[model samples]
Target: MKPSLYIATALMLASTSGFAQRPPAISSPDVHADNTVTFKYYSRTAQKVSLSGEFLSGNHAMTKDTSGIWSITVGPVKPDIYPYAFVVDSVPVADPNNTYIFANERFKRSIVDIPGNTPLVHALQKVPHGKVSYRLYPSKTLGTTRQLLVYTPPGFNPAGKTKYPVLYLIHGGSDTEETWTKVGRANFIADNLIAQKKAVPMIIVMPYGNVRPAPMPDFTKEVMQDIIPFIEANYPVLADPQHRAVAGFSVGGGQTLNIGLTNTSKFAYVSSYAPYTQTEEFQKNFGATYAPNAEQVNKQLKLFTISVGTDDFLYESVKQNIAMFTAKGIRLRSDIVPGGHTWMNCKQYLATTLQGIFK
Candidate 1:
C-alpha cells in the first residue's frame, strides 16, 4: 500500500477530526500501525527539501518526486512526542499538516505526537504527582527581582511530617526557569520515574541561571548565593549537603560545575548536559579556569555526570572535558547519545540522569 494511505488511516484512527478536515497537500509517504510516521511536503519552487530532526537516524535528505514533493518515512518511531521540521531549499519550515508545536530557543517547530504505548516514548506512567509554584524572588547579586519556578515532589508540604532532598536544575542561556518544566518536561519525567520506582522522590528547584545584559560578570555567583539561599529558606527542603544535587543544560551546565564545585559543601551531586568544557571567550570574560587537577575537585563530588549527543556542535569540547576529567582520576559517567544539541537530546539526558540520581 502507498505510504500516504497508511498515514491517512493512522490519522483517522488517532484524531477525532476524521477525514472531514482538508487533507495535507503533501501527505506522508508512509505510516505504520506500529506507530511509525512519515512526512511529506510539496514545494515546487524549491530545488531540494530535506528532513532534519533528533528522532531520525541522521539529518537525512528526503527524496524529491518529479512533482516536487519531498518525503521520507521514519519509524516505527518511539511513542513519545518528537519535534521536527523540514529544510526546503535549505530553509527550515514547519510541517503544514501538523499543529503540534514546541519552542526551541527562539524558534518554533512542528511536533508529531506518537502513541505513548510505543517503546520509543519513555515510560511516564502515574508517578507520584508534584506541584509547581511560580514566584518572584529578589536577587542581591543581580540587584533585581527575577521570576522562577519550583517543583516540589508528591509529598511536598510544609505541614507534612518529612523533609525532602532537592535537585537544583538550571536552564541554559536564552532560556528561563520554565524551560525545565515546560519544554524539558522535567516534572513529567520525575513523576514517571518516581512512579516506576526508578528514582528517589525529591524536590526539583528550577531557577533562572542567566544574568541578563551584556558583559554580565559572575553569573554563577548569582545562582549560588542568591537563588539557592532563597529556595532553601522558602521551601520545605533538606538543607544538608547529602540531599542536594545541581544540574543544567549547555551554558547552565557550565554554571552547575562552576557553582556546585566551588561550593562543594552545598551540592553533592552534579550533572552537566551538553556543557561547554572550556570556552576561551567565557574564560576571558568571566576569569574562570578549570582546575589544574580535577582529582582535587572530583574527590568532593558524590556523582558527576556529563552527557552530549554525537552530533552536537559542542561534542568536541565535551569530549575534551571528559578526557581531562578522566585523566585526573575523576570517574564521570559520560554519555554520547545519537542526536544533535536539540531539546530532544536534553530531555533524554534528563530522564536517564535522574534515574540514577539519589539511588
Candidate 2:
C-alpha cells in the first residue's frame, strides 16, 4: 500500500476501462460524383442484414462479403429526404452510421440527407413555405380535449377574406395528429404542390384519429361524431361538401373509406392510401357486406381514389376493395404504385391525389 504502488494501480484501471468502453465502430460509404449514395455496415457476428425502406424494391437484403461487411447501393433515388432503417437479423434497427433522424409522435426515424438536386429523387426548391400551427380543440365525442395540427398556406391569415378548401389528413395506428405533418411531411408536400401550381391552395387539418382507451373505433362514429363538427366550426374553410376531402394512410386509409362511403354527403373527395379494412371487425362495424349492386347505396361521391404500393402487406386487400367497389357500380380510381407500406408511397400519392382533387 505504498504511494507509488497505489498510483500505478489507479493508472492501470483507467487504461483498461477506457479501452473497453470504446464506441461501436461504424462505416458509411461515400457519395459518388454521380449522386448515388451507398451504405455499408459491419456486423461480423450478425447472421443476416437487410435494408428496408421506401427507396428499395422489396427490403433489399444486403450482400455480405468475405470481409464481413454488408453493403447496398440505393439510388438513383429522387432528390428528397428519405427516412429509413436497417433490419439486422429480423430486428428493426436504426442506421448507426447516420446522424439525422425525423421525429414522430411515437418514435424517432433515422434519415439520410439526399439532396433534391440529384436526378434520382425530388429536389427541394426555393418555393413558398407553408405554416403549420399546432392547436388544441375540445372534442365532445371523446369526452375530452384533443390536439389538432393545421397547415395554412403561405398567405393564410385569419383576417384575410379568402375561404380555402380543407383536406383532413389522418395518420395510421400508433400515430398521433403530428404523424402526417412531422413524419409524412404533409406540410412540405402541400407547399411544393401549391408552389408548382399542381394543387390548389388549401388548408390541411391533421387531427388525432385514434380513439383512446378503446380499440380502434368505427370511423363512422369517430369522424361523424368528432372530427367533422370541429373542422366546420373552428376554421375559415368552406363548409360545403365539394370543398372538403378526407384522406389517410394505413388504418387511417380504412377510416377514409369507411367514413367517406357511409357519409358520402360529408366528403366529396376520398382517398385511401394502403387502407386496411378486411377484418371481421371492419365488416361488422361498417356493415361492409359483399354486395354486387353498385346502386345499393346512394353515391354522392365526386372522387373516390384508392392507392396502394405494389409491395404493401395490404396490397391484396386493397385490390379486392377496388374490385368490390367496381362490382357494386362504384366508379373509383385505383392506383398501384411501385413501393411498399411506408411513408414514401403515401407521400407521393398525397401529392398526386391532392392535385387532381377539387379540380
TM-score against truth, every candidate:
0.74, 0.76
Taken over the whole model, the C-alpha lDDT of each candidate is 0.74, 0.75
In candidate 2, what are the lDDT values of residues 261-310, reduced to their tens digit?
Answer: 76677788989999988766666655553243345333667888999989
lDDT of 1 by residue, 209-252 (tens): 76655212476777677877887788777788778898888988
Q: Report the Cα lDDT for residue 206, model 1.
A: 86
- Give candidate 2 regions above 4 Å deviation: 1-33, 38-80, 86-108, 118-123, 212-219, 286-299
**Clashing pairs in model 1, backbone N/Cα/C closer than 3 A:** 3-29, 78-120, 79-121, 80-121
Estimate candidate 2's alpha-carbon lDDT, on a 0 to 1 scale. Answer: 0.75
lDDT of 2 at 314: 95
Error of 2 at 291 (Å): 5.8
Best by lDDT: 2
